[model samples]
Target: MAALTVLALAVVAFFAYQANAAPDRPGAGGKPDPTPVEEIVPDKPSETDGADDENPALPPDSGDGVRVVYSLSAQRLWLVAEAPDGLGEEVLHTYPAHRSTVDPEPGAYQVTRRDEAIPGSDGVPIQHVVVFHSDDEGIVFGFSAAVDGSLPDPSAQARTGGIRQSPEDSPQLWEFAEVGTPVIVVP
Candidate 1:
């Protein structure tokens, strides 16, 4: 009887923590809206909107050139396209990504490979997988999304490495980010 009471209290505490930890979004488990409505990931470079202009994702000194900036803290992805003159750059698009509890170290990385529909670590059929960061063992963290746009929410104890995105946004990433493209993860 005492153990059951303790477990019930723990569950209540966990729910309270989740309500505070995650920023409220309409599609996220029915939480209250935390920010204004905007396009988190644009379709193209020229067609991008100014929804993410104020909150830049790339860190200063991240350098110029064609690269993708991913912020782990902000859960945002910004595609950068450099100017032909080699002096200026522009943000192609911005996206809100869902990452696993296992985070990759913030550093420069290059895309190593690409593949089609496959079973991700979370046991979901994922497509548009652009492999970038992998540990010495077998963990690989890359850009991918479930074939049906369903997201897998794992607990902290689970060491998942797949970076989930939307079905609508996955194609954009697949078309824009080719093999060997630069990817910089920021805090």
Candidate 2:
């Protein structure tokens, strides 16, 4: 019985030693692995070749609310309105923006409830509770009904003048007169 006990202790000690042995690769699970530094990192350029020079000029009908224009071939959000002459169009505002990550399918506009926290100039908290998108820029521009009543006569000037960026930090226009409705964009 003493001899059997001694053999059992020897087997346990051998297994423990084997279990505690260092792996061939450091910081790995008992396996040989190549150094991380030896792995190649892929290179990605933001702009594609000839993307800029190939950009088409803004179309004649490109007047804004939520128009999508290309900057150096990168898609940009544009806010435009009719020119004062009652003849042509003019660009009002532009912003660089990232499209919605989850549902960015083209040509579909949906008004959804959003409750994002934003910081005010005085460090107060503001929330963006409403968001809308339209395939037509005009529709997006028309949704700013909250600001239409506060402007002076000759409302187009008011729409064009003193325009401020959206509190939501979005490229989309936040305020405008009712006359400035119907955001139009060229394809």
Candidate of highest TM-score: 1
Which ten contiguous residues of candidate 2 have the minimum total lDDT?
140-149
RMSD each, Å: 15.5, 19.9
Task: List, residue by residue over 1-187, the lDDT tens digit for candidate 2.
Answer: 9999999999999988766674643544654332231131212222654123233234444444434332322344454455557675444444433222122223323343233343321223433323443223222211211121221122332221111223432313333212223333223
Question: In model 1, where do residues sit more than 4 Å from their true spots?
Answer: 1-57, 84-87
Q: Compared with the true structure, what per-residue lDDT tens digits does model 1 show for residues 107-183? A: 89988989877888878899988889898766788989899787767575668778888876676677768788999
Which residue pairs collide, candidate 2? Answer: 64-80, 137-183, 138-182, 138-183
Which number leads on lDDT? 1
Q: Report, for all candidates in order, the number of backbone clashes.
A: 0, 4
Candidate lDDT scores, in order, read: 0.75, 0.34
TM-score of each: 0.67, 0.31
Clashing pairs in 1: none
